[model samples]
Target: MAQFDEVFDWVVVGSGAGSMASALLMKQAGKSVVILEKAQWVGGTTCKSGGVMWIPANRFMNPGEDSLEQACRYLDAVVPDGPDSPGTSPARRRTYAVEAPKMLDFIVGQGVKMERGSTFWPDYYDELPGGVKTSRTVTALPFDKNELGKDWASKLRQGFLEVPVRLDDGMKLPFMKHSWKIKRIFLKIALKFVAGKLTGKHWVTAGAALQGRMLKAVLDRKAAEIRTGSPVSELIMDGDRSVGVITARDGRPWRVGARLGILINAGGFAMNQAMRDRYMPGTQAKWSNGIETDTGDMHIELAAKGAQLAQMDQMVGFQMSEAPGWDTDYVKPGTQSTTGKPHAIQVDQTGVRYMNEGGSYEEFCENMLVRNRTVPAIPSWAIMDQQYMDEYGVAGKGTAKKNMEKWLASGWMRRAETVEALAALIGVPPAALGGAVARWNGFVRSGRDEDFHRGERAYDNWLGDPFFKNGPNQCMGTIEKAPFYAIPIVPGDVGTYGGVVCDCDSRVLREDGRPIPGLYACGVTTASPMGRVYPGAGASVGPSMTFGWIAARHAAGLGNQFG
Candidate 1:
């Protein structure tokens, strides 16, 4: 290992998508780069995710499916200029719009095999301008972990799926549409696993695959080094210009100089309660599903050094609940049962519906905050009938349920024979819930959501149970079946979107709007380019890595117009 005092071309902080992308590019430019990770693992929360990159106009997109003009239109429509958000500006949009395809091509050319995401998977807002039904999202190919050797492979962050199958394989399974064919797929998977074990080949999927490929690319270059369990405590400034970082590793502080620049790719502040309370006010860290390593360490440390911030109230909102049996440190994202399915509705403490039930998780949580201003809507309840439990199942419980006694006994789920009784158990007014259900039933019968248009959009139906035998409105169903259930849901976020503001070149800006020389930032450590709205799946990582690449190129004295 080299001494910490040695000067490198670049010192990148945080070993997430942004960090590795920046480090790889800098190394490609014939510069030395070192990556620092706070956790014992690399990859950060990206490894726990689906590892899809939403790169519009990439090689994978079908002809005419995407264009810069349409993409700009979509950005304008989705993240419009307002008091809350400046919207995604044309300059930033153009930067990402052009660089995304190039970034995808560059990484793929470097040995990262990518597959187009689900053909049936629509953009989160498919009906919005420039939105496509498919091909904008690309996922990494499954990688054999054994290729990296056991010890180094085990250091990578593990995916959330405990199964051996990749996300594509899991999504392609016949269990949903063709249940009879599931046995064949299961048998094939079992045989493949057996064969792999016999051959000492261990395959990892999703985020692990993405990180493995990227790490392998870095290692192949032999010019980049990643140090885990190394937390960069402060930026070492030379006059007004950022020069280096002081990292605390193994109980000792060391000064590592960066001759070119330092890129802060540290993650969001979702796990930092004090930051959440201060910046986000009503939101709490306990409700966020973001990685625990994201404690606003970089944001706090850098803000004290005169870094300007923007969109501090924004977050990548989602619906989630406290993960059962896990420590009190985090919340598990809950998606299926509450929204997109029939026979269920999310309601405030007073049992009133506030928003369309089948909307995106981000929209759902945003509405939660809107209602929380004057009502107890932060921790609302997902009220559903036994039909929902039988058809879609409850949160934390899989689609197949052997018994509901344990869930009900644990008090995490409340069961009652009637809606009124359920409301009583959960402390909501009986009439309000009963009326809401009646209105919901009317909407179901008419194949129209008069109050809240749950099934109006293509994205809404995409999240619905396709096999559900309903009318044209797939997300609608009567909640008349007895033995209703209610589970508490809260405002949850995957990550925060606000931090130090950076220019299109990925240079961090000061309060005076001038670039801070030698200091660059990307990922959640900087305010996102998408502003207040998440465009689609992989929105976070797509911009994070793109800006990272941009930052690396710019710091190397390369032009801002990078391919």
Candidate 2:
């Protein structure tokens, strides 16, 4: 019923992983599709991420290691099932478990190269029932951006890593100073760099590689029409059914109609200070590492049309330290390495150890926010000794004389000769600080964290020093050396977690549980199907792409192929 300047079988908003996947599926079905991106760049916040997809029972996994049944059990154990977590119902979880691998296979069939992530990258809750000790994650190999051609390559969003290092290699790079295995990995990376230069290939890794490969495939097929800087301002509703959208083109409003449905893959509101204050209070937008365009415009539009929004307060928390220039850096230096490494422990303002330091980034920041409700733990202090500074350094930077002097001068880090003096500098009670340090030291001696069980999980040890010889537990080491240091750690996030809720088929649902016909959504634009818990690495991206694929299939009259 809406007048249109253009029409397509499917129209996707936001050119993220979900958008790309959905468009690819539509193309495979010979349906006309258009992808509209608000930013000048094509990839969304996904481009700035570590492009990992947690696909359980994927084809690349070793036989007998994973299955759909086990994956469902793991989801049942970890993801909450209640009114508050409606996005992660048993049915939806089952669908995700079953269809995720199919999505991976489809992408691979389309010529995007993918491989299993590190075998050591265990699930975040691997100790739980149905959890795997080894990785179930999938990632794209390092891609040559030249494959996309110069025009498309220039429009692709840049990621944190430009070198051709795999995600596992990047993870191990931090330990190069300690382990011979890491040194060999470094040598291989050096060879890769030389090889790339000689071959005249501009290689990219991480998120960029994943997206670059997908984009190249899409262009090669020439099926979906992709447009950038086209922001969808309104969802054109034909009496409750989303029939089209009002987007900008040529500096004017353009009406685009979809014969099947409009999929909203727009990102979350991590960069919007107002939304952050309303949903997740005590968090600052400046601390978030999400893309600048993730301002939640589509979320507001969807809610205005009676769509149910849930889990508004949840975020994929990435704990960060306020290093010099952290506010302006493309990728803020994270404290996950700092707290999880040896000779370091996080304490509250009252100078007391609260939670396990070597847990997942989501839990790390969630614990900090929850602790802030009673105690002043928003900016928790990470207490470390000279040994930690000498070995692991602080916030991913080497603790050279110049770096330490700069940090000290800028008030980003505090240092002292004794625990008492360091406590005073960081505004903590001296007795409490010294007592906490002594307690931690005692745990190191016994090789057991009786207070919080820091090193009990394989994940904890994976994040710690693998070659630590002095300590029985990889994450347990005495913080007793001289020249103690303290740095403030805050609850930073990759993106917000809450948005309009969707069903198993990726249809946007209203408050009364009825689907809004001709409407679908994926990515952070929808409330996460994993509920409030992060299952493993790439949880967000895996679901986003899978649901996107599901949406396209359903629109094309193919109902739940895997189901």
The candidate scoring highest on lDDT is 2
Candidate 1, superposed: residue stretches over 4 Å from native: 1-4, 82-87, 172-186, 326-333, 560-562
Give per-residue CA lDDT, model 2, range 1-563, as digits (tens): 78999999999999989888888888888899999999999889888899999999999999999999999999999998888877889899999999999999999989999999888898998999999889999998988888888899899999889888888888888778777888999999889989999998888888889999889888888868999999999999999889999999889999999999999999999999999889999888888989999999999999999999999999999999879988778998888988999899999999988999997899889999999999999899999998887777678666645498888889988999999999999999999999999999999999999999888888898888888887887888899999999999999999999998999889999999999999999999999999999999999999999999999999888775533
The lDDT values for all models are 0.79, 0.91
**Candidate 2: deviation at residue 201, Å?**
2.3
Compared to the true structure, candidate 1 yields what TM-score? 0.94
Q: Name the TM-score of candidate 2.
A: 0.98
**Model 2 misses residue 479 by how many Å?**
0.4
Candidate with maximal TM-score: 2
Q: TM-score each candidate.
A: 0.94, 0.98
Tens-digit per-residue lDDT, 356-398, candidate 1: 8765566777788889999988688888887887776455445
Clashing pairs in 2: none
